[model samples]
Target: MRTNLDFSPLFRSSIGFDRMLNALEAASRTEMVDNWPSYDIVKTTEDDYRIAMDVAGFSPDELTITQEQNMLLVSGQKTNGEEVHYLHRGIASRSFQRRFELADHVKIVGAGLANGLLTVDLKREIPEEMKPREIEIKTNIALPKAESRQIEAEKAA
Candidate 1:
């Protein structure tokens, strides 16, 4: 059974969070039927992350990684080779595409393929202006006694 979530209340109260809410709603509605080429996401540090995927039969040239705005796309396409018949085929070498939603400043650092595993590194680099900063509070200086006396004399007059 699939349940639909209503984000109308959040929409009414939240500001500048439309994209996040929309993503959540879309994720809830999507049915992930294909889970081939298993992958894992791990956070190495406070701002570093890694995505490792098991692409056993895919070569470096057969895989593609692209980043656009807040979206990361990874795809693989096997090249046509000599056809070989197998009595019991088990390994999967089909084409597949995977997508990941990245945060505001998350960037792809590097990627490597080894031992049939594709590893992608990511780091979150917050801009200087966007980083948290401390503000210095200024206190008002006290008025001079002569100025206070002049104001009192003028009021008396």
Candidate 2:
């Protein structure tokens, strides 16, 4: 028996968008994707961001955070505790993995674990040219402000 794969549809589609190409490239990196421990991405500021995850029952030693290219990965493992007898068990302390796709120029500021929440801070430093700046408009009226102010307030004050 012979199995066949088709690429006719993909080849027939229009190819002009850079974003679409990037998406295809990212799809090839499925191994980098992580879906564990539940997480939330919050936008703190226009150029600042934070990631909070519920990493309960995981110690700092078992957790590892690293940045690969423009990706943030967080992995943790549950260490084996001392032998004991349990009549009933309900809590989950299994290992987990989480991944975050970061934007250009986005850098991790720091990370902290408090209570049962693990928070990671990220900041993007925009260039001076890219930042919003007020442009000065030049005009032909070169009169002094002192005289112009008195004339404009003749009837007001």
Count of clashing residue pairs in every prediction: 0, 0
For model 2, name the residue pairs that clash.
Answer: none
- Give the range where candidate 1 is weakest over 10 consecutive residues by summed lDDT: 148-157
**Which candidate wins on TM-score?**
1
Stretches of candidate 2 above 4 Å error? 1-20, 24-35, 132-157
Q: How do the residues 1-157 of candidate 1 rate in per-residue lDDT, one tens digit apiece?
A: 7889999899999999999998989888858677888999999999999999999989999999999999999999999999988899788999999999999999999999999999999999999999999999778977677743434445553
Instruction: Write candidate 2's Cα lDDT for 1-157 as tens digits.
Output: 4334343466468576555556565555435544568789999999899999988878888899999977898988877889879798655677877777777679999999999889999999777888799989888977776644444445664
Worst-scoring 10-residue span by lDDT in model 2: 1-10
Query: Local error of candidate 2 at 77, Å?
Result: 1.4
- All candidates: TM-score: 0.83, 0.64
